[model samples]
Target: MSFDGLVTRAVTYELKNKVIGGKIQKISQPSKNDIVLSIYSLGKSYKLMISANNNEGRVSFSNEKFENPQNPPNFCMVLRKYLNQSKIIDIEQYKLDRVIIFHISSIDEMGFDVSNKLIVEIMGKYSNIILTDDNFKIIDSIKRVNNKMSSVREILPGKNYNFIKSDKFNILENFDKDIYYIDKKTPDNANPKELLYSTYLGFSPTIANELCYRAGIDTRVNWGLVSEDEKKALNKNIIKLRSKLLENDYTPTLYKENNKFKEFYSFRLRHLQYEYKKYDFISEAIEEFYKVNKSNDRLRQIKNDLERKINSHIKSTKKKITILDKNLSKENSMELYRKSGDLLAANINKISKGMNSIRVNNFYDENKEIKIIIDPLKNPWENVDNYYKRYKKLKNSISYAKKDYPNQIEYLNYLLQLLDFVERSDSINDLDDIKSELISNKIIKDSSRNKKSNKEKSKPKHYITINNSHIYVGKNSRQNDYITLKLAGKHDYFFHVRNAPGSHVILKTDNFNENDLISASYLAASNSSLSNSLKVDVDYTEKKNVNKAKGSKLGMVYYENFNTITVDLSDKPKDLYKRIQ
Candidate 1:
């Protein structure tokens, strides 16, 4: 949503410098709504990505790789026929709007030179990619809108290409005049930030707020209520911004809050209180923003699914344990059954076959009188035998329930830990590792059965301590198993959050200093769900002391000879070591 008109302008400027006169060497449609062009400019290959996806629509020079289909789609084939080996003549934006037009010159099938145009509209849900001839007649569009979809514009073959009509004035063309008009036309109750974006082209709400902030005016205040001094400041700021745009002075920046990426802008954003990650080129910033956001979105979706499944299983396991507990409670009366049977046998002489019941003293309870029911037809001996048989069965049930209860509880804890791992996963490969673990444990069905093979195992995150000792942290249970059992040396130290779900961090050296141990502990705590806790207990032990339980889940290990170290979860060490990818 931050990819507004200014971003488009910046991208156009970047492309004008990099891709103008470049040859389109190859074209690929990796997705239905996306196209990637391989261009060779100044002996360097650049991938220009154009996407029409409703959620992530934009144009940028991308470093991300996409897998293309084995057979090219019809749209890809059409683009190849018209634009293959074509030279980019010029790149321009449509009147400061979020639409970019590319002019190309290429030879036609008849061996005659021809000119064509490619238009990319970066409007949210209505974004599109259209190819037209020099005459501005539509050749083809990635998405065709007919009369049924829209009456204002029919983007089909043979239709003439035109910019969508809007009432907003272009800010770059008539800045002073437009500002004067905006000041007069804005109502008293209108928010200054909203007025700027609604009345002018190329200004997103973010940029509008930035302008108001730079002018030292409250963006939430009514535009008509702005003081004369503030009005002059606003005018000066707008003029300065216009000059920067004309001069193509773009300071592309990506903003983050609490270490999470939020948005990117074509110019510096003073209104937004966030950590800024500046980039030399706007294209690079855009690419990084989308790449990280897309990956996070993907990982989140996978994690949610896994979390839901694990929670459901946990509920079911709890229900099973509850039922077992109830049965065990009933089984606890087995001793009473045995006593009743003995009393009946002792009272056989006083009871007759015709009697339905008899009162007898309970010798086991200090001769207290109790009622004893008997099957009159079976006589006392037969009743006693049946009681003993029932008691034996209940005793066996109690024994089995007692043994199974702890195992079920442990399994439940294991699942909770797995859920924690999924929530903490940082990358797609980490999620894949967890998915594999779930499938292997029969906790979930393998949905990727149609794939040729399982993905290669993901490696653990590796780091070096300040003492130059290596520390490997597991991103998931599969990686945890690897780090603990295979990758670790016998004398190497292993650290984990005590009695909590966290990463298994292995310090891979026998000669580690106190700083190395503390650093490893901090790394373990940071990767856990309890990282927000003020203090976390981290347990460390030699790798040889930790052993996986027989038939236990992967990464479920028990250890002895471990020392507990309480660490401040917020004490993240700096320059501990560079992470090895």
Candidate 2:
């Protein structure tokens, strides 16, 4: 899984053969941390991707599609100024370290010839893509590190580019036998694997383990506690390793678990064994690994963002509904105001002004005596009018709340439905559809709406039931509307989860039997928020009996003459012919 020294060497070898003479045709910074260069060579095109992401930095030949921003980044523009249309004359690796350099030739503004070196350092967190002239004076870099950022090495313009100095000797080029001797005074606590790899450039831990294993030396053994015979075996294997690497006899291999990639290296790693696949070139293996990993990471980020936005709105909606419920509770006392007013009106003629309360007979309650408290500063009739006015105000407020509560609840349900959609989405396209729905509903702001919509919209997933009947499940709100309102036949059966946000599922056959209906119900339940419920209620009715609510949101509908089917999700079939293929 590590993009180690050998992997870098292999990628550089392939890139040299394919792109040495290629012209830099396009330069794009698809993301802030990555760049893709389109190269034209030997009557063909190639994309060389350079990534500076801390966790997943690499230099590889990639054909993966990366969407570019509408405005090119400043570093991208800087690269275009110097490298655009330039021919790559040479590609070199820096002493087998994780750094690659490109010697480029181009014509300047005044028709003067210019030579440049574009350096890519693949160190983990300090990775960078730097451009400099032939004298090594820096031009600009994809990532700018000022003095405040790193006092050890400042990668900025107008500064001399410095190689990260390492005291380690080259294992192949400068092989010294005296350094390998295990002396009585040598340190006895260091791991043999660590000692070998740390003492030489381009020697990885895995390769060191292999060397130790091949020499009959325990990789866990202390480096200073080796015997003469074991040292001889180690020397023999190290020489063979040098010969293999020098001769470019690498076997590009990738280890996998359950068809998912786990580890990859330029050569066969003899120290470890697992289920693996071999490729003709290391670029292929490396590209596929990064593509899948990067895509998964990107999707997770977006899903979290959308989930955060939706959950915020859902929280606010619930709070608003709680406040409205409290207001509605005031309706309980509205009748008291009306009754107080009635009692005061009857006692108005018997009372004078400035009386705090009037004692009277309550004819409405079996003629029992009742007391009505009033404003002593006002006449009895004036107090009666004040009570009446207060009662009418309470009536109006309760009435307004009664009418608005259902609408607010409906909107809250709609937001909940969108949240469910966000969780079930598996692809960027599905998420994009949901994002567009949110923007259209004014729930989110996105400027991409002004972009062209010439791309055809994706459709719902269509499936074939066990009875050879057809079923469809919408993946988003737009598709839900398309399935229920535009695609379904009037006699077709409509299926949905009864009190939850779910996909709109439609059965496209009227002559279907019980099994067909159940299959449709299964689709509806599986694609819903209630998919994991022990028992799920799915309502099914003829499409003609379902009507979209007037002035309501998309996919919001009411149905009558429907039959409910109880589905036990634990009894789901292994396969219901879910796809047409």
What's each prediction's TM-score?
0.89, 0.83
In candidate 1, the residue pairs with backbone N, CA or C atoms under 3 Å apart (3 or more residues apart, or in different chains) clash, namely none
The superposed Cα distance between candidate 1 and the true structure at residue 554, in angstroms, equals: 1.8
At residue 555, candidate 2 shows an lDDT of 77
Residue 236 accuracy (lDDT) in model 1? 87
lDDT, each prediction: 0.87, 0.85
Residue 206 displacement in candidate 1 (angstroms): 1.8
lDDT of 1 by residue, 1-581 (tens): 48998899999999999999999999999999999999999889999999999978999999888999999988799899999999999999999899999999999878899999999999988999999999999999999999999888999999998889888878687455656666776678989888889888878898888888988889767777788888888888988888998999999999987645799999989888889989999988888888887777777888899999999999999998997787689865899889888998888788777778889999998999999877879876788898898889888888888999888878887887898888887778878878878888999998873755556767888887667789999888878898899999899998999888888999987577878878898988888878889999899999999998888877789899999989886667777777876
Model 2: lDDT of residue 490: 94
Model 1 quality (TM-score): 0.89
- Where does candidate 2 stray beyond 4 Å? 28-34, 65-85, 105-115, 133-140, 144-149, 154-159, 174-200, 203-244, 247-279, 349-359, 371-382, 447-452
The lDDT of model 2 is 0.85
